[model samples]
Target: MPDENFYLDNDDIRFNLTHMVDLESIAELKEDVGSPDCAYESADEVVETYLDLLEDPIGVLAAQRIAPRAADVDKEGCHYDNGTVTLPEPARLNVQDLAEADLMGMTLPTRYGGLNFPATLYTAATEMISRGDASLMNLFGLQGIAETINLFASDELKDKYLPGFCTGEHSGAMVLTEPDAGSDLTAVQTRAAYEEDHDHFHLTGTKRFITNGCGEVLLVLARSEDPEKYGGGRGLSLFLVEKDETVTVRRIEEKLGIHGSPTCEIYFNNSEGYLIGQRGRGLTRYVNWLMNAARLGVAAQAVGISEAAFAEARAYAQQREQFGQPLDRFPAVQEMLVRMRIDIEASRALMYATAETVDMEMLLSEKLERLDRKDPRYADLRARRDRFAKAAEVLTPLAKYYTSEKSISVTTDAVQVHGGNGYMKEYAVERLYRDARITSIYEGTSQIQIDRAIPRVMAGAFEALLDEYADRDYGTVALNGLREALAEARRSLQAAVAYVNDQKLADDQRDTDYRNLTARMVCDMALDTYLSYVFLEQARHSERKAAVAAKFIQDMAPRVEMNRQYVMSGDRSVLQQFDLLTGAQS
Candidate 1:
């Protein structure tokens, strides 16, 4: 078994949750935060209860149960036997332990026999699981399925499926991608035909690259009506497809990494499925509901992988002797380790901030649903909930994009730190590197995440928030300098955005080029701002974190300015001379 000491302790999780981010204050505004009977049991208690669970021996169980199996699962992968897709032995054992521990439904509501954990807390657990073994995070991190059912499934559907899911009796798949409609879900060709006599939908389609596609239950996105009649997401409907004889797992793809989570090409031939939510709202509503949770899960998985990579590199650096000294004593090696540490921490800071904000809103919305229509305060709470929901919509994808991409960078560097040894199958960093590749690709690609974030960026939501961050009093004279440096980077991003808008593209290529340039500036500034705020919060506790934060701002501020300048001043060389760049063409 791997060293359990590397797993995230309860104190570290709490530190990230409570101090670096504003979990309790946000919770206080949320009515569904705590027990109704005791008003005195504030959000603080709610947070502590959550932390206490992290300290449980179950914490050790949750992290350890899956750790030992990661390697074998990766080696054996998933096997499709006849119609049934059999998971690798290690994968099977890992899922079984998760189910037995009731961790499969980590973020689902208690009403569905789940733990009713906050997204932040759930993400923290995900990080721990990922650290132990990145491959297992795919299986363990998909509590999104239960969350999806809780939000969209009717009482009948929820009653039938959620308990099984919560208890780990069932695993699930999001059956959205098809051969033609990988990224463009609006192009989904899977047909969900309504049966007038039976009043049930019969789904017939082939879905490719479906993650955990062989799971017991499937949330399928299918076209129910022609676009000429209903249209796009409006033509689409969500279905709860129980895996019976009608649905066949034709084959599980030989994946590049995270092989434990079965990625299957499924054939749904006249499969019976219950409609979830209203007709024509499946893609628009249910898919959105599912994807939001999934996006967050990806962020957690990324963090976990980072944790694993960091542990491997940090441990190796301390033990591995170089030039008659420990590698840590060497400047180049120390720099590599420092960068890896910062990368992980930066990703984590963004993940927790996003999760905390989103969970608070989820809690508020749950409370609002419980409030009577006649209650005087119901309207106010409902309005606040709506605002938080919108805020979460912007933040979730942003965090997912930032963290997953960071994991790719950090994990790759982790392997690099081990030099040639990292490339060998014997090293965990090699596995960690492969595992991290899937984080940005699935649950929507980094491109998709940015497409989601771009609207929020264009809307100037972060610009307004920047003002709020600027207004924060960094009381220490030394720290105030770093705050000013961050403010400058925020302005550079603003200038870059203005430049992009000023350059109206006539061609698709030019438009894409401009968007990519703009995206870099936006993401860079967002990360800088996020870290600046994280370190500012850290200053409230440790001087060490404050110093790290200060160094981060100083290093990042100039990079932000340079990126912004490239966006603003770099030639529209692509726009001005496309033919020149194309040369004789391929």
Candidate 2:
């Protein structure tokens, strides 16, 4: 029997898709391209057909197949025997069900056996799958690896790997991390050298902390340039290696959460492989693209976990009694529940917006490529493409940083709402809390996201977005106060950016020195302002969202102001007193 409580039935996702997303534009783009499998005549038809045919089935799978087995899968985890990794029986069965349903390749082109859905719909599906079992997302989300191959690999390579991916006969792993190179990927020591006699490259090195490393296809980043001749990231190149005897699974890490998702340590000993894209551009071009997509996937995963956590808390609070009344009747419990709900909605709004932008960027790029360079329409299309591309650069990191961090906080609070019961293994909140911890750590850390976002905030990328939001008028009089609050938050963000710029000019190295210290402050301000606007826009069509917007702005605007003040204070005491503060390193 299907769990009637599937998170996909949540009203907010449906509202966002129907009202907030630009489905008309997406439909027109798809129709213009004469989509092979999906040929809806109108935007409404596309949305209706997608929900009925694709999204609904995915939701059913999550409720019936995935969610029911998640706990058992966690207990069993994955097995390591000799050099092979075997998934828990429940996990293995879940994968088979998803593959048999043709749900593995949601975003790739139809010609490659994918559904060819836009990123927004794909994100929606990912959220549902993650909510069912966060560990399963590790396998389902790896479809990005296949998408990368479709985008950058040769036609020969595409024909070789994509069909297997769609058929569930193959899975993939991104093999990049080494013992010495975790966050600093440029330090990777893996070697991939061409063998003249064999006419194929041979990969040799150890890759640690690899997710799904035992999968059929592996994307490995290796040093193609000799270190003595070329150093740093310029020496790096991407390669595609299939599972063979030459590639060995050394061991799988016993992790705190997501136990069903094996994190393997792999040894590639002269593994036969083929190169991807141009040499010397792997890290800068290909891997960066892969990382951005992965980050968005993490953001969706975070949202999914939050949804599950919130549901558990809300249901428990409503049923569990204290002093002869439901716990939800208590004011303290009410506050926690409301805050968790608000955070979940805010995070979803931001995530879907980011996904929509990414979809536009991808669709426009494809359209631009198809047009003649000398065509007059090409210039306009190029401008739209670049705009969305830049938006994606800032929004992707923001979505990842904010949503992942919020998931952890929300899950912690969910446990708190459950009190002693949440600490027990019997409660789902306990597992969710553990699972939420890694979302902010991998793909890129919260600190890394702040560092990337600081320069974009400083350069006025967010300023235009803020202005656009401010200029839009909400039809309801009730939302005017929320609009004003959003305006104030935007102003506060601008002040923080101005202060950071002034500090940067005061010292030649201040940008490098002080940026990291103050980056989080700026990012918080940006997130609050951005989400406030997102919710406000959502309010135009939804009364429930109007209340969500009101509560979020009323609660969060003050914090944004406080963060701005902290940035403006220009306190350098931490940097100045580092030695004293640290007590001589021991």
Give the candidate number with the greatest lDDT.
2
Candidate 1 lDDT (Cα, 0 to 1): 0.78
Q: Write the per-residue lDDT of candidate 2 for residues 1-586, one digit (tens) a residue.
A: 6455354468887887878888668756754534554466666776665666434578888878898898998889899999989999999999999998888887777888888778788788888888989999999999889988998999999999998999889999988899999888999999989898986789999999999999999999999988888798999999999999999999999999998899999999999989898887788889999989999999999999999999999999999999999999999999999999999998898898888889889888888877899999999999988888888889999999999999999999999999999999999999999999999998889888877777888898887677778877788777876787677788788888887877754445556567678888888888888888888888888677788888988898789978988888878888888887889754
Off-target runs (Cα >4 Å) in candidate 1 are 1-12, 25-44, 372-383, 505-513, 575-586
The worst-scoring run of ten residues by lDDT in candidate 1 lies at 1-10
What overall lDDT goes with each candidate model?
A: 0.78, 0.87
Q: TM-score of each candidate?
A: 0.93, 0.97
Report the Cα RMSD per candidate.
2.8, 1.8
Per-residue lDDT for 554-582 in model 1, tens only? Answer: 77877787777777775667766778888
TM-score, cand. 2 vs. native = 0.97
User: What TM value does model 1 have?
Assistant: 0.93
Backbone clash count for every predicted candidate, in the order shown? 0, 0
Off by over 4 Å in 2: 1-8, 31-38, 505-510
- Kindly report the root-mean-square deviation of model 2 from the true structure over all alpha carbons: 1.8
